[model samples]
Target: MTRKIGTEEAIKRWNRFADAYAANHTELGDIHKEVFLNPAIFSLIDTVKNKRVLDAGCGEGYFSRLLAKAGAAVTAVDYSPRMIDIAKERTPDDLPIEYRHGNCEDLNMLEDKSFDLIISNMVMQDLADYEKAFQEMHRLLTDRGCFIFSILHPCFITPESGWEKSKDGKKLHWNVDQYFYEGTYEQKLGERENMLFFHRTLTSYMNTLMKTGFMLEGIIEPKPSEEMLKKYPSFEEDFRCPDFIVFKLKKR
Candidate 1:
């Protein structure tokens, strides 16, 4: 049986790996974000100008900065103190953003229905209590407000999923297993540090959103655009299978 990790352990691992994780992120985020998530996320939302935006689980706050630059009033929050500090330091003096230390499961500091839109990039999987996080997000958004998040594709990125590589180290088919297992699992993020991620099936995610009173707006299995593929040819491998999934939900 896979041992279930608590939220505190998850946060501790995040705090420890925060610096190394942030190192890979630029203003556009890592290669995966640059190629897949950003496009899918931005496509779902309309204009951000003069909107109230919440960057839930906003790591180093790159997306928050982007939203601020685009004329949104941005409030960014992260569970890790180190991440919050890095976000503040990385944020320029001009971009108006509020950085808060808080967990996505319970953001009581921010009032209910306080946001026009909430964007959580590559964050949901890292959370241990995703159901609570969903409820919190529902509470945070105004009526008709949107909540957009990206996570690892639940069906494909399972605990026992990886490449079935050949002996010569040549490319091979992607393998997936244990799709029904839903709990915390440690995944290597850096050379030594292992990060915790909670895996739930796609049905669970969809049903949870419905139960939380979020109307399903849209879903995207992010694929690198032609422009992105031109810039990063290696991402052509993404055509074989999707690595990420983005969802747009409206608070109803």
Candidate 2:
């Protein structure tokens, strides 16, 4: 879980995990599908329906396919070409979704005022230049357009503090206190081209958003379900610590 995020490492790991990541969720494991398509985020107003939408850092176009299904002019972009190819293959014939191979930070390929809604789903954590990405989203959005995005909640959630079953059939807790070490890390693989999420403080996130000309509209803190609590007893820890956070934003 304490692996590095980068283009070199992620290009291969994501390719290897692309099939699985598409089939299942990488962070929430399909339990919280609403993280990407929540009513409060995408459907809060009259934006998605028949509106030109941009899904930046779209991995395999899951939300892009959903937006297309909802009658939106969708243009999905990702940093990985392999991801774009897979996304193109997965979209339905009449979805009207256009998958483009582009970096999230530099969306110069898209003209100004090209989309009504620009969505970046759980991908902000994977980018190093989010300030530039925010600037590009502002440039791409219509005069009153919005950019809704989701990311790993940095303040409370740490990737290394996860629980997995050991061979001895005992539940062991990992005490990985790597928060002090805020630097790039690579995966077990030899590649190192992906962007490992550098967790900034919550104040940092909000300040950055305000500095980038975006107004925070709504926030979604999704919790595990009752079934999940019954199935996995350890999930109740979220009562004290939440896991995921979805945010809604508009051009300021």
Candidate 3:
């Protein structure tokens, strides 16, 4: 049986792996973000100039810094204290950003209807209670405010899914199983640490957002653009399957 882990345990693992994680991230947030997520996310949203933005689960705060540079009044939140510290260190003193240590599931420190837009880059899957996090995002947004987020494609990146390589280690098809299993699972992040992630079905995610009073605006199964493939030739393999999904929702 897979051992159940709570939010506290998850945060502890994030704290331990914070430095290693931050080491790989730049202003664009690692290679994956640069190749896939950033394009998808930026394509969905309007101008950030003078917009009040919240970066939920702002790991290392690269996205927050990007928002600030793009002329948004950005507030970044991360549950890991070490991660917040690293984010602060990376951020230049000139970039006006508020780095707060808070969990996405419970952000009472931020008032209701406080933000015009909230972008949670690759965050929802890490939380133990994503439903509550969605509710909190809803509460934080002004009327008709936009909430954009990205996560590993729940249908493809489940606990029982991976590559099925050949004998000579040639790439083969991706395998997916146990799609209905929704709970905590251990996933190795780097060479040493195994991070905790909660899994949910695609239907569960959609239904939860609908129940939280969010109007689904758009969805993107990120595929590397031709420009990205030219820079990172290895990303051509992404054509075989989507590794991530982005969603744009609005509070109604």
Candidate 4:
């Protein structure tokens, strides 16, 4: 459990990033592509030809639109009104897509067993109640429906332990002192606004999904492409840490 961030505060924090978030990805272009193709998300999209899909934490609806373009009937949902607005704008009007404003913890507004596939990227750490969210996911999925998601890898990404390492000796290093302690981590994006996340153990995460009735399918940790490495000088060093993890689970 963690300190609860009210819906209002959560909404406000994401609103700050809404306008620039897509542009940031656009700016990162190849960099963004590399991250998306990262291990976690890749293994889950085996075949998305014609399925009902939901982008659960669709920050900007980028993946949601991608799935729709790939022939899936897609619905993208986000708690932030600002995010939903941006998602709607980016989505093509002709696509069979819906952008809804809703929290992950309670998908009560949506019909049960309505989705065939669900995808969420970088959403786990942002949630205030993962259990409730997982339960909703289970309820929303039809029998054997697939739920795929990604998050910051708990094993490697610990804050302030230093996001830096050396070329020799310890291939992996961390600040043990800072690693164990947990608190509200705030990244000051502006004078009045900030980015937030919650940190938890890997075991905690696996258990939650299992209890919610998902059979863990796979876990992936991706590396940058050689071409990307040649272009970005710091890619090798900066990407040593597993930045993200994807989980594929079948609803049972």
lDDT of 4 by residue, 1-252 (tens): 235654456668888877766666542222645544533475667877888898898887777777787798988899888888887887778888888999898878899999998887777677767788889999999999999888766666654544335676554654323455344455544445777776767877888889889998777776667766777666676564666677889998
lDDT for each residue of candidate 1 in 86-154, tens digit (9 for 90 to 100): 999999999999999999998999999999999999889888889999999999999999999999999
For candidate 2, lDDT tens digit of each residue in 119-166?
A: 888776666566777788888988878888877666555535454558
Model 4: lDDT of residue 171: 47
Query: What Cα-based lDDT does every candidate model obtain?
Result: 0.92, 0.69, 0.94, 0.74
Count of clashes, each model: 0, 14, 0, 0
Better candidate number, 2 or 3, judged by lDDT: 3
Could you tell me every candidate's TM-score relative to the true structure?
0.98, 0.77, 0.98, 0.86
For model 3, residues 1-252, the per-residue Cα lDDT tens digits are 154787889899999999999999877899999999999999998989999999999999999988999999999999999999999999999998999999999999999999999999988988989999999999999999999999999989999899999999988999998889999988889666788989999999999999999999999999999999899999899999999999999999
Off by over 4 Å in 4: 1-7, 27-33, 36-40, 164-183, 188-192, 231-233
| TM-score of model number 1 | 0.98
